[model samples]
Target chain A: MIARNNVVEFRTDLPGYPWQIAAGDGETWIILRHKARLPVTQIAQLKNITMKDFNWRIFTKALSKTLFQGTVSLTVQYSEAQHHGEELPRETWVDEHLARESFIKDETVTGKNIVRKDSRVKTAFSSILLDKNMLNTGNESPSEGEGIWHLELPWQAWLYGTGKHQNPQVEKVHIAQVGLNTLLLEILIQLTANNELDLLNTQLLEYGLLPREELIFKIEGQEIEQILGVTVQRVFHQPVYDLESKKLQLRNFKEVDIIFISAEKGGERILTASRLMEEMQVIPFWPRDWKRPVDFGLFNKWLGLVKVAADQILFQGDYLWFVRSIEEMGTEKITALEEKRKNTLVAALPPPRKKPGEKWLKKDKKEQPQSSISKKAITVRF
Target chain B: MVWQFSSAGYMRGQEARRPEVLPQANPEALPEVTVEGLPPQVLSSYELKIKSAERKSPNSWLLNTSQGEYLLRELPDQSNQAKTIELYLQFSEQGIANLFPLEKTKSGKAYEKTEGKLYYLTHYRKGNFFKGDDISHLRLAAKNLAILHRQTGGWRKEQGKKQNLWLTVKQNRLRDLLAYLHYLKQNKVLTDFERLFIENFDFFYDQGQESLEHMVLAGQEEAFIINNLLPENITLLDDKLVFLDITKWNTGPQAMDFSLLLNSYLPLHRWDLDLIKDLITQYHQENPLDQKARHLLLAQLRFPRRYWLYSHQYFSGQLSSDELTPKLKRYILECYWRDICLDQLENWLIGEWDKNDSKE
Candidate 1:
């Protein structure tokens, strides 16, 4: 089982000792040791792993003791091997026959008749073989593609009677390894590579699990059209951003990662990165290495864990600046927004005298229907 | 109007002693009441007088008298004032001096009549207005209010009408909000804020409707409730707290009193549930709440009155949107607290009820 520190260790009654998985400096390592000696190391670079590099197999056998006694045995093997070579040397084989036992619980049903053969084979091979021709000729130059033996052989093995006699009586054995984190890490790396990290973060923030920073955007120029396009599709229509007026500054943000770009039509506006996460509908797998109270150090660690491409860090300063701006701008535009709101309201209201055949406008009101425009001296109540 | 002049023959000075022979009433000089229209008896009665008059729904005088300070005021509804004063008099008889406007006129009438105008004098309760955010004061006030409510519980003769008073108030509030929404829509130009309000009108309107329905479902019995329980009306009398105004007393659900006081005291958009829960629990300890009462209380709180009030005022031009914008945002933020308060109250109520159920 994996510990809180992400270290994993498991033991099996196999030839080797326990297997351990650990992370150091964001790199994961898998270690296998044999009875306190002979340690084999495998580096699992989660960012580089694919589905084909991992495999495991299971084997089972049964032994008969007496007329009604039997024992089942199970073994599991896991290996990560890369293709290096194909053929090997084969020598001699010895076969021995053994007696079989018939045990039947039912009177009419007997155990199947079985023939068993145990084969012992021995073979020897050398990775480095001396060439006698080169020794005799005393050749000073080395020739390529020259080896002691270049042999290719096709070999096959089968159990007699559909492998019934080959380890046939064993039950089930469960074998599992920590491979999920590797796959998840791979997906995250891929997403970062595709520049979709912001999108994923956006989805997470939208789920509303994490705290969000307040951001302000001044959507104007052609951005008005862009905003209207987004607003029109919503089920509930609000007239908040549907204007094609001046450089209208609107303040209110769902998240902190925001960007504003100028375009020819109305200017394009986008909320990027940290703030982008706010609009996310689904929570993404956290990219951070450490748990909560996430600060700058934790964020940097997360970036390292995700192995964010070096090019992305160039914009890190920009992201930090944007976040800082959001923090500084808190509650500043509230007053201005409110002012603009009042102006918009006044602009939206009709002059008391302008409405055709309006009865609510009193005789005195009709004389100066719109009090706001009447050059009336302002009164300071406070 | 019994205008007490300088007692019948006291001013007849033909055989009176000279100024030097006459004994001085005060060795230390008293401030002169020099206004031409002054009542002669008022000047003679109070030695040290500092008086001012201000109109606040009634012609009232703030003056220092020989007896003590007093708020002399006229009443719009003499009969209602009499009824409330009678209820308070009974409460005072039970040692609930914190309630009941203190010290009536010598005639025992809560109000004295002058030119057919009914007036009354109350000894100025020495204390500051309930202005601070100290929730302890709120807790104390709530406790006293619950006591006051329970003590005067049986004063209402019209039980059926009072029982439905909360429902009527909610219905009226919802009606008012609707009217304001209509007024907002009637404007020719609308701001983004106004538009947003209109868009979310149904959601807010539904909250009002739901609160009313919950009140009806709870069906709590009514008690004598202070209908206008503004925080400013509460005064700290030395160690004791008292509500100075009994202008709008009515037979209503006790929950109305709780809602009024809370709505008045809680800071804008900061509905600290701990404060609310503590206050409620403190009050409940004084006067236990039944399941129905708890439900009614929650229902009363669930209505977003501040948001509605600010928005209504802004749209009606009674207040400039710009002037109330910060306040509006505050109210909006406070809106979230309503749900939190409701959820917590519901949990506590359920927990308490379950414990009671197990005991039974």
Candidate 2:
């Protein structure tokens, strides 16, 4: 902590992203949007984990991401600031710790960066979603419109943030609308009956962990712009306000890791993932195994991120963003933050090695025991 | 007929159009019968019933829809809480009833879960003077519980298979008391009343945790269910009594279930514990009261509010309404907190209670 004629101590934790805090000393800093990283050693672990166990990689990466990015506030000793002589006309005082802007962000914004480019499943499903009120399609009326309130982006949507989980082909687009049927309503009503379900359900009200809403889905196996047989609804574009409907209030916000994997159709695709690259996009992934530079279905590989636009899940925090307005300076700062973010990512990517009996270009000589593979076609009762 | 529509936009109750209800009949009864009157369900067998009426669980549905009424239970799956079904006879005037052995699909499964928890459907036995109240009948039940302990002694032991936290907790306390016993060659923690209990434990544990289990298997409340009887689970048709839904755990010590009942259900000048000694004395074979068990029971009796208040706190609102009447709830809470401090006096000497009462 360095004391000056005016400016207080600057932050030393983020040395890579330095701050020149001598304001009007002509020293200015583009305050980094966020601090995130995945070291080189972690990458090796992730690689080993990916080869050794798939779920281990997933759970590990999820946990690691949270551990690295989890925000915890701290406060050291601070004494009352010696007030400046100049009648700090608001602005100057605003910067004062006494009047310091707590830096509250909008908690949400127009979503972007959702798409995958893997060559796995045949084609991908992609849709666009925008904040509902962005269009200002205002309609204040009686009758059927009573429940129709302002459609603001949710303060915290269920599947908001996380590294990535989707197809590998859809072009980068600002998601416009996503149709979802959080099974929360069914769970709640089913629980209110005071039967055995209600009794068992009582054990699940912990924070950031609620009984997940059974995902209402329809998959035709073939790529269609909309899920086949499933009519798509508009994005759940709404404010964080509860609509007073027990159904709406009880909505479960959760984060799900949906991994889409495929090799050269017939190649062995198992690997370790004990550790992982903290931050990376859909591109520039280097997989082992030679010949033909194989991949999964690239066209529909990426459908984008699942942004529900509300705290509709207990698993969230990855998809949130905030900028006072679409100001270029703020957005530019964010971009710079994104750039610095990439360094920590590539450095930490796990370099997986083929096991002793395994070969890069060769598929395994033996298949897994029949008992290990799942046979039950996880059926959902409509 | 569906009763209501929940916010999830689905019909509630019998006609909710779930996949299909599983049958609750013996598969051998109807090899190929399609129960025409029932909703579309996957049933193994079909049979005649006198009637059917919707009832709260343990007995989910009382069937008078035919000649002889049966009980149908809609079970929940992966459910943790245990409720009695399959065996408790409810002979209420609600309908016609008859007693029959448990009937299950030929697969020999007593219950099955389709969309929810498992349910059991059985013939309701005809009976009289069945007090179904939650906590009474334990007094009369003391003897019946003893009989059950004697009868199902072997099979039930095989059923429970594992010891819960009981033996370990008892032994942990005993090692300290046992060492004290060795040091003083006397029961240090027990009064003469409790000394008997400690001796019981010393003698019991001398044989080990298995001995405790044996005591349980052999109808020992000092090692199992207390002898305090409740009239609720008992059926006294002019002294021809019956006890069912009987478990190895609930049929122990004469003090096990009875003392608590007197306190909880009967409005008395402080749950007349006088009934406890009497109940224990009445047991057909007087198992000597281990001084240690006496001490433990009295100590436990001293903390009765804890067991009742806490038990009620977690599960029961039936004693009160949705449990929201805060003043009453507050009174219970205040008594609980007050007792936490005042209980020391009550635990050591009842006179302290009168002293505190006089000061107040």
Candidate 3:
């Protein structure tokens, strides 16, 4: 069921390979090599399983009774042909993959290298015709053996999908690639959920899955303006996530990509890229970690309160109300702390000594006659 | 009033009445004992033994006494020194201590009245004169003024009467300007000052009228303002501002103080818009200013106050033709830069107002 721009073809030229089968939408292709003859019924069942229903559990269960022996390899590719002429160089993709691999390797908890050797950029030549619209301008005709670089993953067909799907069909392939990071995240989440404190604590140290490198894809400035609903002068990315200390928990994809937006008028706002993605409701595989610190929840509550106060300022045109609210909150906090201190240690402390001039000043003021005039009746005229 | 004099005070009174103890012809020389016409009973009433007395201004004296150094000044005709003292005492009671309260006499009177004149004493404060050139000083002064405003703002609920004081002030000035124009036109032979006043009359008249219209539109809020907030009246001592003069405190629009401060200081900076903005922001941090207050402030700033002042002075013969001509010329030249700054400020204010309106 591949589109015309994403036709996958198989070659049976190699000597050791008997059956060469390829099936997928162009970005993610499943290549199968069978030692035993495959039945027509099993092939029909495999075809019926679209990418949405395709998951590790379903794949394994569907093939449980099949008396077949074969190897299934998954290849994920990013190419200009698949995207709408978006140029993601093969070198850039390879660099990102290596960076992610290095990040996983640097983690002390995951001491063993989890990245498989087969998960590398593998060059393949395909003369499959593409839709005219898929071709880049000035390249009216492409020759055979055009280099198509792709990652040949060691993952079997059973480990391919995790059941999450994006809205647009085209983003499904990229979402599948992102699912690899999600899988690693899921392990951490499950460890935490299962109350395996010792293991979870060990893994929580430097346990990020995605590379903290800048992404090849960028959200345009106009899109950012739409998300913030403010006139943006400039947007800056400030990366503050620390994988070694695990300071900022990996609750969202691209959490470190914090946007510092300065508006045209005079104010500034900071927002996380993950928060923006959450607002956009895109990026399906971004799973939020449920077991967050209580401080984070309180901080979010304060942020919401500030936003409500700001709305009050805007609606009522009483800016002082917002300032007073903040001051009151501060005063309440200080008073609460002072009360705690007074209850604990104040009784043991000696009373503060009066300054040398204090007594005299007090006596002098006391000696003055109380005026008969009411303050309300007194007005100083110029 | 019955004067109570102690046995020692009778002798001091006899000594103060001597001609040698009176004000000398050379003001540079300190008086031997007491100020001119200051009754010895007034000094003895405060239990003050004067060491030396020096004239500081027309009706003020710097006195060093056995008690302490003090500034003794006479109040003007419209001044209610008792009410001023009460207001400041109330302010001090309310924990607003920026102003120096009036020191009471031994009889607990706020001021001593003798020969139909009112005189009061206060502890002499020492500080450097406030510098308008220093931005930090400007910000501090603005913040302190705002604090004073906030304290007095509460009084609005209790005592302040709502009045369009700016409208009255602007109308008076405009009337004076029109009278000056008529006087200049009536002159059979125009002097240089009269000629200059006639030439610049139309532009300044339009500006005055425009500001009056703006004031009318802004209406009024009950605001107790320090009417004379000149830099000379503020002192910066040990990072704390001491408002030296509280006698001119009056009930008016809150913008009156802000406008007065800017008018007094903007000439030092040649009317820099950013500096004005910064000062406003500093003030706003302490006490929030509404859009109407800002409009009134801008309106007051836009009016050609100096133009009117010089013309009125010249027309009333308070200033000679030779004296008024140069001052008016310089003022007209300065108005170019002033107008540009005011226009930019107006644009910014309009833009902000529109932005807030759109938000609503």
Candidate 4:
């Protein structure tokens, strides 16, 4: 009789969704509803793993009894494509160091005009992998592009510790508010179905690359209005105290913005706008002499820059924001901002009181005021 | 000031709500605790009959007489009886429902040291222990915690010294695990199973360290925390929730206490977002949390505690698959849902507290 523990069921309710397992059924084919991809260079590369092949007993025995709330009795069975195939496409092993050098060369197309577009993903992946503490650093090779193992993007970002990113303090705050991993998994599951792997993967990849930074260069809403030649009403407004200045200021924050400019030919024009961090805006660049609606070819060029430079970009409405780190910055200012916010919150709270019969509360000395000035929401123009 | 409840129609002999509530035995089934050296006045001229006895945890008994029921509790050590009495009295004063030690002994003491054993007697209240799945019960537990913390604020301030009481123990355990894994490898005693555990240690340790750093950054300690806020320790009465074990209370961040409750309950519900939101909202409504406190709670939840704990046990050669496997399964399941829950909880908190945004 089968142990019943070996039986496994997979929930592929969401495409590109990681597996949610439960123990049931004696027959051992765990179906993948979304066509879970395996980089199958050849059929011979496939490795069929059965319950007897590994310690299915340990995992099933562990997961079944308590968490899934019942006994999981089954023999585990699964197959995956591996690197070395028995027959066709036999590849020679090359030195990884040499391959890395070649990749760098390929990354720069010709004559100092780096192939920035093609190498952007590699760069982002490399930056994330270089951090020794990130969980991804151990499993993923920075230089390797195609692999048997691929982590869906924002999930990948989470495994790479949030603090290891370009803006640690902001990411730290962000991670605390909505844990990166859970937020992404839940949102992705809700937004996509089993057949939408391609869309889900693309969205995940894009959203995972977006980052949050304090000194950001956004085309101020009014400036965007001037460029698009339209009067726009802000829907979401907040009174934010800017970290740099001590004045309170009202600002509009949008998760995503797409501006449509009428082309001379008179159709529809689409220009995606994303915030670029101040430090990365080394060269003043913007689309110029672009006809409305903007040419698709030209827009793609602008989108490339947005993809690489922006820490966070909202690609579509109600979809996840792309979060990534382009350049590492000193976190001193961010840390100071965090401390100030906490102190402000503490100050706003009602003072601690002594319970009746607890005389010590009355005897306590008053807390000392913070020496640092509170940051203003509005920055003074120089 | 405690209100009495009638035990009628209460299903008196059924298993109490918690798993920790041992099966109740008949009153005559067990031998009575020796009251040999205790002053006669402590019993107050009533014949005390044992209603229930628990030998495993804190060694206590439920006693009933013609007047009313009383709980006779035994202390682990005679020296700490005074401290226990003091804490219970403070808890009672703060509107926390606790069995305050009765001041009936001849010496006007809350506890009596008889024949080198320490014991305290208090009026027992009838209540059902809390179940992890009871949403209302969970909400009440969190609200009661906030109230308890608010009341204990003054006491927390008096004990001004800061202590990372478990830091040394955890750090030492991590170091020992590393050494043990190395020794196993060097001696050719490592199995494939052991190798898998060894491979995962770095990631788990690093994850644990990252969370610990976040806690240090948040500096969240403020209220007197009940170190063990397990669901079993909370009981639901007709009108109020009563705390069972008061012996493990300590001074620390309320996050530490709340996180323990959340962790315990998360697995029970398989990390249901609606339930988690309800629990956190109830707690926040009672005790408002600022940015720092929220982050501290997240940090506590985010810590790779199960990994560190089991790895420590494995290194100590104390890990049995029966216990560790189920916990690991629950950990994985909760981790899968952690981020989603944290995000919603944060948004709810920010939406509530962001007065300027709401006004705009």
- Per-residue error for A109 in candidate 3, Å, reads 92
Task: List DockQ, one per candidate, in order.
Answer: 0.00, 0.00, 0.00, 0.00
Error at B195, model 3, angstroms:
2.6
Candidate numbers, best lDDT first, in rank order? 3, 1, 4, 2
Q: Candidate 2, after superposition: displacement of residue A350 in Å?
A: 75
lDDT of 3 at B284: 79
lDDT winner between candidates 2 and 3: 3
Model 3 local distance difference test score:
0.44
lDDT minimum window of 10 residues, candidate 4 chain A: A170-179
How many steric overlaps are in each model, in order? 19, 109, 0, 34
lDDT, residue A97, model 3? 24
| Regions more than 4 Å wrong, model 1 | A1-382, B1-58, B77-95, B104-108, B157-162, B168-189, B315-317
- What CAPRI-style quality would you assign to candidate 1? incorrect
Per-model TM against the reference: 0.41, 0.27, 0.41, 0.42
Q: Residue by residue across A1-382, what tens digits does model 3's lDDT show? A: 0021221121112211222211111112122221221111111011000121222222232311111122222221222222121211111212222222232232221212211112111111111111212322221222332222222222232211122322211111211111100100000000001111122112222221221111222222211221211111112222233434444422322111222121111111112122122101111222344333222100000110111221111101100000001112468887988776654322233345667786566455558754444233222322
Off by over 4 Å in 3: A1-382, B1-37, B47-53, B65-68, B76-79, B156-165, B179-189, B353-360
lDDT of 1 by residue, A1-382 (tens): 0012221111111111232222111122222221110111211121111111112222332231101112211111123222122111011000000000000111111112111121111111011111112112122222332211111111111111111122211111112211110010100000001111122111222121222222223222112111100000001111122133311111222212211111121001111122122121112333333322111110111111111121121111111101101123447677777666554322233333556865664587447544545442333321
Candidate 4 per-residue lDDT, tens place, A1-382, comes to 1121121111111112332211111101111111122332211111111111101111122211211111111111112224332211111111111221222222211212211111111100000101112212122222223223222221111111111112111010000001111111111100001111122112221221222221222332211211211111122433334334333233343222222211111000112232211111111122232222111100000121121122221221111122122333459977977766654321233344546886444443576643344433533222
Error of 1 at A112 (Å): 96
Relative to the unseen true structure, what is the C-alpha lDDT of residue B92 in candidate 3, on a scale of 0 to 100?
39
